[model samples]
Target: MKNWMKIAIGLWIAAVLAVGISMPIGYIPGLGAKARIIYFHVPMSWLAVLAFFMSMWYGIMYLRKKDMKHDIKSASAAELGFAFSILATLTGSIWARFSWGSFWNWDPRETSIFVLLLIYGAYFSLRSALEVEERRATLSAVYSIVAFVTVPFFVFIMPRMMTGLHPGEGSPAPILNANGKMYMEASMRYVFYASLIGFTFLYIWLFNLRSRIGLLSYNNHTEID
Candidate 1:
C-alpha cells in the first residue's frame, strides 16, 4: 500500500475511535450505554454492502474484459465484504443481547444477515471447487453477480417488511422523521457520521491491501507456471 493510503487509514482509525469513545451521547430509554455499539455496528453494515457492490462491479468488469486482474479485484472485495458482514453481525448480536434480552432472537435483521453470509460463503465454496483458472474466474464472477441480487432485499427491504428488533421493523425500531434522518440527538448524529466516514476510509484501505495481495499472488503463480 502507498504511504498516503497508510496515513489515511491511520487518521480514519483514530477518528472512529475518538468519536465512538469520547463523544457525549444522550441516553436512550432502554439502550443507554449499549447504544454506543451503533457507532461501530452501523458502519460495518454499510461497509459490508458497499464492499459487496464493489465486488459485483469488478465481477462485471471481469466478464467484459476477461482480465484476471478484474477477477482478483472481485475476489478481494468479496473477501473483505464477508469479513465485514461477520463483524457487523457479531456487533449487532452483542447489542441485541443488551437491548432485546436475548442473544439470538431470529429477528428479521439477524436472519437477513445470516442469509447474506451463506450467500457469500457459497461464492467462496464455488471458487475453491474450480481448478481451471479461466473457469474459476468466469463462474465465480457470474455467481457473485447472482448472489448480490439478493443483498439489497435482504439488507434493506426484508428487514423493513418483517417484524424485527432492527430499525424500521418492529416496535423498538429507531424512529425516522419525514426527512428520513434517524431520531438520534444532534451529538450522537455527529459521532455516528464521523464513524461512518472513518469506516468508509478504512474499507477502501482494506480493499486496496487485499487487491494488492491478490495481484502479487497471481503474478507469482503465472511466473512459476
Candidate 2:
C-alpha cells in the first residue's frame, strides 16, 4: 500500500470510530445503546469471510499453477481470516453478555461461528503436520476449498435456519437482517457502509503487507537452499 493510502485508511477509521461512538441512532429493539458495536462487529465478520474466500481463491490458483507464491498468499489469507474470526467471536460474546445476560448461550449464530473457527483451526494444524512443502501446499489448498464450501452454509444459512439470540431469530437485528432488508437510520446506514469500506481497505493493506513478508521469508529460504 502507498503511504498516502495508509494515512487515508488511518484517518478514515478514526473518523468511523468517532462517528460510530457519538452519532445518535434510533432505538434498537433488543440492543439500545450497545448497538454501536455493530459498526465494528459486522465489518470484522465480513472481512473474516472475505479473507477465507480469498484463501480459497489463492489455493485454487496454487493447485492450478503449482506455484509456491500462491501457496504463501493462501496461507497469509488464512492467518488473517483466523485472526478476524477470533475478533468477531470476542465481539459477539461481549455483546451477548449484555444483550442476553450471559457470555455464551450456545445460540445458533454463536454455535455456527464456533464451528467455523474449529474448521479453520484444523486447517492450520493440517498445514503444520505435513513435512513436505508440495504435499502441505496441495493438502492445504484442497482443505481451504472444501472448508469454504461449508462457510456460506454455516455463516449465512444455519444462523437463519435455526433460532438464535444473536439476531436472525424471529426478530431482526439492527442493520443486517435475514429477511433481506436493513432497518437502519439513514445516517447510521451511511456510517455503517463507510465503516465497511474503510475496513475493506484496511484488509487490503494488511493482506499486502503480510503477503510481502511471507514472500520475503520464502525467498530467503529458497536462497539458502
Candidate 3:
C-alpha cells in the first residue's frame, strides 16, 4: 500500500471504531449489548475467508508462473488468514458466553470454525515439515488450494446445514439473514459495512507487509543455499 492509502485506512478504521461503539444498536433478543461483537467478529471472519481465497489465488499463480514470489505471497496470505480466524474465534467465543451462556457450547458454528482452524493449522505444519524450497512451495500451493475447497463448506455451508446458534434459519437472525440480505438499521448498516471495508483494507496492508517479509526470508535462504 501507498502512504496515502495507509493514512486513509487508519482514518477509516478510527471512524469505524467511533461509530461502531457509539451507535446505539437496535434490539436483538439474545445479544442485546453483546450484539456489538458482530461488527468485529463478522468482519474478521469475512477477512479470514477472503485472505484464504487470496492464498489459493496466489498458490495457483505460483503453480502457473513457477515463481517463488508467488509462493511467498501465498504463504503470507495463509498466515493472515489463520490469524484473522483466531481473532474471529475469540470474538465469537466471547459473544457465545453472553448469548449462549458458555464460552463454547460446541454449536455447529463453533465446531465448523474449530475444524476450519485445524485444517489451516495443519497447513502451517505441512509447510514446516518440508525442507526443499521447490518441493515445499509446490506442495504448499497444492495444499492451499485443497484446503480452501473446504473453506466454503466449513465456513458457509456446514454450519447452516446443521443446526447452529448463529443468526440463521429458524432463529432471529440479525443484521443479515439466511438469504444474505441485510436488515440492519440504516445507521448500523452503514457503520457495519464501513467496518468491513476498513477491515479489508487493513488485511491488504498486512498482506503486503507479510509478503515482503516472506520474500526477504526466502531470498536469504536461497542465497545461503
Which structure among the candidates has the greatest lDDT? 2
**In model 1, how large is the Cα lDDT of residue 135?**
97
Candidate 2 residue pairs in backbone clash:
none
TM-score of every prediction relative to native: 0.90, 0.95, 0.93
lDDT by residue (1-225, candidate 3, tens digit) is 689999999999998988888888888665677777777888998888788889889999999999999999988998999999999999899878878789998887788778768878988999999988889999999998887787677666776667777754466456434667676678777888899999998998999999999888878877998
- lDDT by residue (176-198, candidate 2, tens digit) is 56677887788889999999999
Candidate 1 accuracy as TM-score: 0.90
Sort all candidates by TM-score, best to worst.
2, 3, 1
TM-score of 3: 0.93
Query: Which portions of model 2 show Cα errors greater than 4 Å?
Result: 173-178
Clashing pairs in 1: none
Can you tell me which runs of candidate 1 are displaced by over 4 Å?
A: 1-5, 167-179
lDDT, residue 159, candidate 2: 71
Once superposed on the true structure, which residue ranges of model 3 sit more than 4 Å away at CA? Answer: 175-177
Q: Please report, as a residue range, the 10-residue window in candidate 2 with the lowest summed lDDT.
A: 167-176
**Candidate 3 C-alpha error for residue 109, in Å:** 1.7
Worst 10 residues of 3 by lDDT: 168-177
